[model samples]
Target: MTRARTSLLPYLLLAPSLLFLAALFLVPLLQTIGLSLTENGELSPANYQRMVGDLNFVPSLRNTFVLVLVVVPAQVVFALAMATMLQKLRLGRDIVLWIWTIPLGVSDLAAGLVWLAILQDRGYLNSALMALGVIDGPTPWLTYETPVALFFSVVAAEVWRATAIVLVILVAGLQLIPREYAEAAEVFGARPWTIFRRITLPLLRPSLQTALILRTVLAFEVFAVVYAIGGRNFPVLVGEAFVWQTDNQNTGVAAAYAMLVVVISLASTVFYLRALRTPPEQQP
Candidate 1:
């Protein structure tokens, strides 16, 4: 009786959470999948076919991939540098981290708007450039004709807004790392770079895995910021989905696009899980 009750206890405790997950995530996911796989009251791949055939589909897919490729690596590098600085800081670490994490409280739309104010032709960036005699007039960066500029503008906003999440994860991960390992490495005359490359990074793998999975998923789902900053100038996967749903009144196609996003995100998560697989013996 005791053993039976003990085994039941864990599942009993998990029941509510499992129910919640099913209600919130699994249910919606099944619905989306069904929607994506059906059209006109019949089971068909029509929606996906329409989605892929859409004029904006290829551009949106390419831009989303480009944005993810640029933004994810940049954010990881920036967050790692910021986390390293925090770990070494002897003064105002909390204040600096608090300042660095200010972006965390900002919503996607709001962050995009914030950068919009800075990067718009007549916005702060152009104004500052003009003030410094770098430009004679306001510069149009977020425009279709300036594809390179438009791309970088979106990338910058994304990096600024999302890097803080990675930083927080890494900071927590770094905190968990015992300082003695680094100290012992130092005693053995290990260079700081060598210590980080071997000790800190190996210990931080779990956190890196988590950060990559999360950021990669979000990168695929990038929308509002691109919409806000580049508008229709820069097409992204989620943006095209929005256009299909609201602008074109095609819920089926939108659902198809969404399913594609989910599929890509799942693949990326699986890749990270396998690539960053930490053996039980290496678990920190």
Candidate 2:
């Protein structure tokens, strides 16, 4: 009876968390899936077909992919560098990290608005350029004629806003690494890059995998930042979902878009799991 209670205790302790997940996530997800499959109070795939055939669908899909491809790698590299710097800092380390992570407190929409103010015509960037005699007038930095520039602006905002998340994760991972391994490598005259490449990176793989999976999934769901900066000028998957639900009043198609985002997010997660597979020897 004692052994039975011991075995049951673990499940009892976990029961609350399991129930919370079911109520908060699992139930809503099931509802969304159900909504995606129904149209006009009947079962149908028309919602999905409508989502696929929408005029903005291809462009939104492409832009989302482009942003993810451009932003995720840049954030990874930047976050890793910042994490390494934080690890090496001996003084004012907390201050620097606090400053760096300020953006983590800022919402996606707020970050976008902040950047929009800078990139808009007659905004700070143009004001600075004009003061420098770089241009006679404010340039149309976020204009429809300059779609590439607008795309880049969204990418830049996303990187600045989201890199902090990745940085925090990598910093925690770096802290877990024993300093002895790095010091031992240095004793053998391993170059800075060599130590990082061989010792630090190999051990940081698990953290890297976690960070990548999270950031990539968020990238696919990016909406507010793009909307704030580019509006309908830069359509994206989430934006389309918003339009279908709010503007078009089509809950079925909106659910389809949501499901599509989930599918892409799942697919990317699977890809990262495979690509960043830790060997049995490296498993923690």
How good is model 2 by TM-score? Answer: 0.97
How well is each residue in 34-142 modelled by candidate 2, as lDDT tens digits? 9999987899999999999999999999999999999999999999999999988999999999999999999999999999999999789999999999999989878
Model 2 misplaced regions, further than 4 Å:
none
For candidate 2, give the lDDT of residue 191. Answer: 98
Name the TM-score of candidate 1: 0.97
Report the lDDT of model 2 for residue 237.
95
* Alpha-carbon lDDT of model 2: 0.95
Q: How well does each candidate superpose onto the true structure, as a TM-score?
A: 0.97, 0.97
